[model samples]
Target: MVQTVQSADGTTIAYEQAGSGAPLVIVGGALNNRQSAAALVPPLAGDFTVITYDRRGRGDSTDTPPYAVDREIEDLRALADAAGGPVHLYGHSSGAILCLEAAAAGVSVRKIAVYEPPYFTHHVRDEPWEVFANKVKTLADTGHGDQAVEAFMRHAGVRFDERVKQEPWWPAVVALAPTLHYDLTLEADGVVPEERFGSITAPVLALYGDASPDWAVASAAAVATSVKDGHQGVIPGHGHDVPPEALVPFLIGFFHE
Candidate 1:
């Protein structure tokens, strides 16, 4: 079933709920909404009441900006409240960052599973991200949404030409060019402090792919080291993008326990 929750900031956050056990909230990466994690949801719904949401400005969610990371956190809080409080949470990429911040802010998160959050340290610098953001911004300014989506694919390490054509969500990514800048801004400046991580009371499962960027691995390691009850897993063949089969089992084990 689909519903709307009003965030503290008054934005209407749209969410879909399926299944019937412990509630689990799934947060998707940039340019993704409830549909991005479709492959994992059915299996997950069998074990838990999976709550999938369109983060602000995407899918069916409403967007009212002066975008701030805290506002995004509030959206998650509202969803958790609707789920009857303190639900298990999972986030991929930028969504992981949001999960971390929400837990830190004392949200009633039961457990968290983070998949390859791009928390760059000195070990990895995001040169391509800045360039890509600027190029996309230029394209959007010039009203070239198509070209902007192409640039986003390159920045995300996804090949634009053949694969984008084959993927169903490629056009949706292009349509959301205006909000992509908000994601970049958050990535560049809104990292959670390492010291604050220790205060998160929720059990955390940090997953990284062995083939992921050095920085993402480093970030996962750092998060595991800092959180008191955190565990780390390295998926052998995957990178930042996790296969649904791999992710569902990990999440079910952690959350349903």
Candidate 2:
């Protein structure tokens, strides 16, 4: 059954947990809800009490106006508290950036792992950050959620094909378009904050798929070196959307270490 926790600002955050062991919270990336991590849960369930939650402004969770990255950190802190102690936190894409920020902000997490955070040590995209940011923000704030989603996907190298549009989850993804702004906010210029991350004493594992672009690999490496206790891993033949089979082994090994 899904449960609820009140964030520091009183927005209700919805979540569910399974299995029986140390708490392991899985944070979804942009356009994702709790269901995004559904496939990883059962395999990890045997060793951990896997927890997945809808971030504020998406799915079963409710949002407060005036989104702030710190508020998102508080949401994770609330989940960590609800788990009764520190947790093993895992995040993907923009969610990975949030995880690092939370750890740096002193959330009680035993360790953190991230897959393919979009940060780049060397800027890759030709579009100026301000131009891209404003374009997406205007589109989302003007009630053109579908357009905002399209813009984000296109910029991220995701193809906007008819097959993708026909998927049952496409509407759900578009409905989450506004949260794309929040994800961009978390990324903040798409560079790793070395000084900010230095504050995180917890172990961090930054993983990238072998098949991903060189920029992603470089970013992941930068992230690993930024934290006090950080490591990097490569999952063979995977990309941003890493399969559970390729990902679970890394989580099991890292969290256990």
The superposed Cα distance between candidate 1 and the true structure at residue 73, in angstroms, equals 0.5
User: Could you estimate the TM-score for every candidate?
Assistant: 0.89, 0.97
Model 2, 1-257: lDDT tens digits are 99999999999999999999999999999999999899999999999999999999999999998999999999999999999969999999999999999999989999999998989668677687778877888898899988898889888888777577778888888889888989888877888999999999999999999998887899899999999998999999998889999999999999998
Single out the weakest 10-residue window by summed lDDT for candidate 1.
120-129
* Candidate 1 overall lDDT versus native: 0.81
User: What C-alpha lDDT does candidate 2 achieve relative to the native structure?
Assistant: 0.92
Residue 31 lDDT in model 2?
Answer: 90
Off by over 4 Å in 1: 123-138, 162-169, 189-192
Clashes of each: 1, 0
lDDT for each residue of candidate 1 in 1-257, tens digit (9 for 90 to 100): 67999999889999989998889899887778788887878889888889899999888999887778788889999999999987999999988878887899888999999987767664433565577667777886688877776766676677557656567866777777776776676566434477888899799999998888777778788778778788898878888888997777778887866
Which ten residues in a row are the worst by lDDT in model 2? 120-129
